[model samples]
Target: MTSDIFAEWLKRQGHLVFKTKSSYWYSQAARTFQAFPYHRVIEPDNNEINEFLKEHNGVALRYSTPLSAKYGKISYHVLFTQSTYSIEGLPKKARHDVRNGFKKAGVEPISFERLAVEGWELRLDTLIRQGRVRAETQSAWVKQCRSAQDLPGFETWGALVEGKLVAALIAFSGDDCCSILYQQSATDYLRFGINNVLTLAFTNEVLKRSDVSQIFYGLHSLDAPDSVDEYKFRMRYTASPVRQRVVFNPRLSPLFNPLTYSALNAVHKLLPGNPTFAKAEGMLRFSLQGKKPLAEQDWPLGLLEQKESILKQY
Candidate 1:
């Protein structure tokens, strides 16, 4: 895909993506690996990302691994906001109080049409100020937009405050489903409950359309140390699994697996404070831990037998 096309597509969708000078075509030409490489997936800089995609069809994407039923898996948290008006056990009074709190805090619903491109830019600036989007992720996202502009169907929604961008959500709408792709909110705005407000607003928007049946909250990681579970539940979104796979291409040699594992351990030990690693590792461990024999209290998602399949192949 041409970088120019991707850039225009994302801009049209109201994403705050900044393109690089180099194209994906040029980066692919420089690759030495034969179908596979031993390097771990690292967050590449804006320049590095654009350069890398230059080789891989000039598109950027993310994927997870697939697992067998015997090994166990988690379910992808698929919540039907239309039917999910209430959470399983959360008190109705608590939901009302939360909505009241949001209104009191100046949280308001905003249509996607009302959220202009400038609002997205402003929101991104707020994120940078709060140190949410690192330089690498930011760059990769821009390139990704450039690559996906030609995609058949895409949708987006967002909310603003005082003429400034506060919260936004982007997704792809299919025949009967909506898959959330990304979400962002200014750190300061999050304190004002814009995240929750935007979520409810967006869900309301989708629910209004008879064609849309369910909202895929994407993947949830029990591994998240950040604990956004309660918040997602508050929005009436259920917890589901997304499977992650790690593979060593046979052509790369037999030692690749052992070497990769060792390197990962070494890197984790070297940078225990890295937020990205924590988020990634948290998801992996959450699934693995669920399969082992443990006391009821020790298991977070209750037990594997108590619920439907949570493991999902993304």
Candidate 2:
């Protein structure tokens, strides 16, 4: 039988095998979807995985943490970035506070307003310059931003340096909390501590008045794990577990509830360093080494890349 035919036969026999290359397959000998979650597959390294995940703030954060079988831990993170309680009396006063902070440091707070389109565009460029993202992936990100903008509760804000964009953030406001999706700042401005200023401004303006009780920093993985977490932590934010589960059934599951529960139990019996325990580790490697630009042919749907080129370069 041809390799395809043989592989099909194995699949039919309830053996779990995955494609390694164009035509080759290998087996872990499992049958249920709840048995293997593709997202949990360890391929690349942890750094790269974290970088790739930075673009999709939630997903990266979701899988970056240590996994547990407890139903409450399925989601790895959550925040008040999505609350819609109407930050009434705080943000209006941000300009004054930012200015005060700047003045205290013998600097001026350069103000700027960034629409979603411009914000994403600038973010793509920032990623490329930093080498966290390749040019092609930035293009795909632009398209994603356009779609995400129309969704309810999406917002972004930033501070400027001498009329040049220095720091910015993207977030979602919901009924109770806000989910900070992405944030960036120019390297040169790091010494100025613009990130702290930006966070304080965002909280005072948006979170404080929006009636939003908390700010969710998304996920805390090995890569830049503490970068955002540290900032939010100082702002009186506390970590809360948002649980997630990966399930594998040969067939796509319409409902993953029961099987997900089973998979969690099975995973718990396993220890750290088991093949699955290294998903983020493998993904991190892929993101770091696979610094290749996205092919144009994969536009609008290509996965994001993660690398340390820019950090290394500087």
How far is each candidate from the true structure, as Cα RMSD in Å?
Answer: 9.8, 18.0
Off by over 4 Å in 2: 1-101, 104-136, 148-151, 222-225, 250-314
lDDT per residue (tens digit) for residues 1-314 in model 1: 33344335544544433433321112111121111110111222345443444533332222232233222233344355455453223457445544643563443434444444334554465446534433234444555444444465455555555656566666666546666756766666555666666676667667777777878764544233224445665566764433332221223325434345456556655766554554434433433443443332133442243333322321
**In candidate 2, what are the lDDT values of residues 159-240, reduced to their tens digit?**
6665656677766655455667677666556556566567766765664464566666655332232344544544444444
- Per-candidate TM equals 0.56, 0.45
The window of 10 residues in a row where model 1 has the poorest summed lDDT is: 32-41
Alpha-carbon shift of residue 132 in model 2 (angstroms): 4.2
- The best candidate by lDDT is 1
Query: Which of the numbered candidates is closest to the native, going by highest TM-score?
Result: 1
